[model samples]
Target: MLTRTEGIVLRTQKYGEADLIVTYLTSDRGIIKAFAKSPRKTKSRFGSSMEPLTHSKISLWGKEQASLPKITQSDIINSFHQVRDDFHDFISVSKLVEMLMALSPENIPNKRLFTFFLNILHTVKASEQGSKDVLHLITQIRLLATIGYAPRLKGCGRCGGKGLNFYPASGTILCSKCAGTPVGEGKSFVRIHDNTVRFYTHSIEWPIHISNRLKPQQVILSELSTLLDKHLTYLLSKKLQSSEFLAGVRG
Candidate 1:
C-alpha cells in the first residue's frame, strides 16, 4: 500500500553506490526507514528531501511486513537553510536528530515527541541569537517528558514537602528533610540549588509557547545536564555519544 505523511528527515546513509537509506520521524507512523533510489545522482527523484533536517511530505510504498519501506515521492516543505548555513546550528540540529533516533521507539505513535522535535527545529532556525546549549537543554527536558521519565518538580516525592530538590537517579523531587535520607539501596540524594529547583519547577509548568521566557542560569544548565545524564544512563543504559561530541564542538 502507498501512504502519505508529513515527516522530518532524521538521517540518511549511502546504500550501494547511488541509493540512500533515509530515516524519518513521521506525523502518523513515528519513525520510518525508507529507501531512496539514486538520491546522490544529479537526476535523482528524491532530491534534497532526503537530506537531514529537511521537512517534507512523503509518499511511501511497501508491504506491511517490510522493515524498510520504499519512498515513492517526496516534496520538500522546509529546508531550514538558515540553520544549515551556520556550522554551529547545523551540528546542534544534527545532534538533536541523532538523539531522537536513538531514544525514540520504532513505529510508536508519539505526537508530543513529534511536535517537540518540530518546535525545536523551528526555534533553531528562527532565532537571531542562537545558543546551542539552551536548545540542547530544552530538548533534554522535553524528551524526558515525552518518554514518561519526566522528573517531578512539585511537592517532595517522599515527604510531600513543598520545598523540593531533584533526585535524578529516581526522577523525583525530594524535600530538604528527605534529601538526607537514602532513597534506595546504595542510592543517595544530590543537593539541588534553589535556582536549579526553581528552573525545573518553572519549566514543567510553563507551556511550550512561553518556555523561552525562562532563562536558565549557567549553573542551572550544568545541573540539568548532569541530572539528565544520570537519569538517561540509568534508563537507557547507554551514554549519548552526540552529547560528548557536542561538548567538544562547543569547546
Candidate 2:
C-alpha cells in the first residue's frame, strides 16, 4: 500500500552507508519515521528535501501497520534552510525540536500541533535578527503550552496560591504552605522574578505573530530559559544536547 502526507523533517539519521532514517511530523500522521533508500548519493532524487526542518509532501510505501515505512518520493514545500543555516537560530530552534520529539508520542494524529510547528518554522525564518531571541523564547513557551507540558508560573499548581519559587519536579510554582506539604517536601525550587512570570503569561496568552512586539530584558529571557531547561531536564531525565550547546555559546 502507498500513503501520501505532508511532513516537516524533524531529524534524519544515517542508515547503512547511503540510506537514511527520516523522522517527520506529518499533517495526517503525528510523528512517523520513514526509511529512505540512498538519499545520500551524489545524484539522488530526494535532493535536499530530507534536510532537517524541511517541509515536504511525501509518499510512503508500506502496509497499514508497518513499523518503518519506505519513502518513495519527497518534494520540498519549503527547505527552511535559512533557519538551518544560521548557527544561533538553528541551535535555539533545535531545542524546540528536541522537546517536541521527546514529549510527543509517535504515530498519533495531531493536526493542530503540526500546523503550530510549521508556523514556528516560518516565524523564525521571517523574524529579524534583533528579535530572534525573544521570538525563540516565546516559541518555546507556546510550544510547551500547546502540548500541555508548559510549567505553571502564574500561581501554585495545586492550590493556585501565590508563590515565587518554581519547582521543576512539580513543573509549577508551589506556595510556602504547599511546599511544606508531604507531597512537595524536600524538593528544590528556583526563585523566579515577577517580570519573568508576566512575560511567560503574555507569551502563552498573546498570538505568535505579534510576539516580536514583546521586548523582554535579557535577564528575563535568561531566567525563563533556565527555568524551562530545568523543567525539561526533570521530565526527560537528561539534558537536551542542543541546550548544552546553546549554554556554551552564550557562556
Candidate 3:
C-alpha cells in the first residue's frame, strides 16, 4: 500500500552500512519505523530533511498490517535545524524528542499531541537566551498532561479546597487541611508556592509557542525540576540521559 503522512522525524538509526531506519511521529498514523535507502552516504538522495526534529511530508510504500514500510520519498516541511545548531536549544529539543520516543506508542494517531510538539519545537527554535530550563520544565509538564499523566494543580485532592500542596507520588494537589493526612507512607508534603501551582496548571492551556513568555524564578524552576524529575523518572523507570547534558550546561 502507498501512504502519505505528515510527521516529525523523531530519530533515526543506521542500517546495513549505508541505509537508515527512521522513526517518525505521524499526524495520521501514530509512530512508524520506515527504512530509507542510502540516507547516510553523502549523495544518497534522502538528504538532511530526515534529521531529527524536522517536520516533513513523507511518501512511503508497503503494507502496514505486518511489516514496516519503506520511505520512497521525503520532503522537509520545517527543517528545525536551529535547535540542532545551538547547544542551548539542542539540550531541550533532544530531551523533548527523547521523551516522546520513550513514551509514545507505535501505530497510534495522536494529532493533538503531534501539533503540540511541533509548536513547542518552533518555540524552542526561536527562543533567545533566558533560562531555557524553564521552557523544558513547562514542556515536560504539558507533555505529561497531553498523555494523561497530568498532576493535579487546582483544589485539594481529598477535600476539593483551594490553595493546595502537590504530591509527586500521587500526582495530585491537596488543600492545607488535607495536607496533614498521610499522602503515602514516608511521603512528606511541603507548601509549594501557589504561583508554581498556578503556572503548572496553566501550562497545559498555554499556547505552545507562548510557553516561554512567562518566566518562573530560578529557584522555582529548580524546585519544579526536582519534583517533576522524581515523578517522571519513577513513572518512566529510567533516568533521562538528555537531562544530564541539560544540567551540565546550565550549571
Q: Which candidate wins on lDDT?
A: 2
**Each prediction's number of clashing residue pairs:** 0, 0, 1
Native RMSD of candidate 2 (Å): 6.2
Report the error of model 2 at residue 227, Å. Answer: 0.9
Cα lDDT of all candidates, in order?
0.74, 0.90, 0.76
Give lDDT tens digits, candidate 2, residues 98-148: 999988889999999999999999999998989988988898899999989
Error of 3 at 164 (Å): 4.4
**What is candidate 3's lDDT per residue for 67-123, written digit by digit as tens?**
578888888889888888888688867776777777777888889888888888887
Better of 2 and 3 by TM-score: 2
Displacement of the residue 170 alpha carbon in candidate 3, Å:
1.6
Q: Cα miss at 237, model 1 (Å)?
A: 2.2
List candidate 3 stretches off by more than 4 Å.
43-45, 162-164, 174-191, 238-251
Model 3 score (lDDT): 0.76
What TM-score, over all chains together, does every model reach? 0.79, 0.92, 0.83
Candidates' RMSD to native: 6.5, 6.2, 6.8
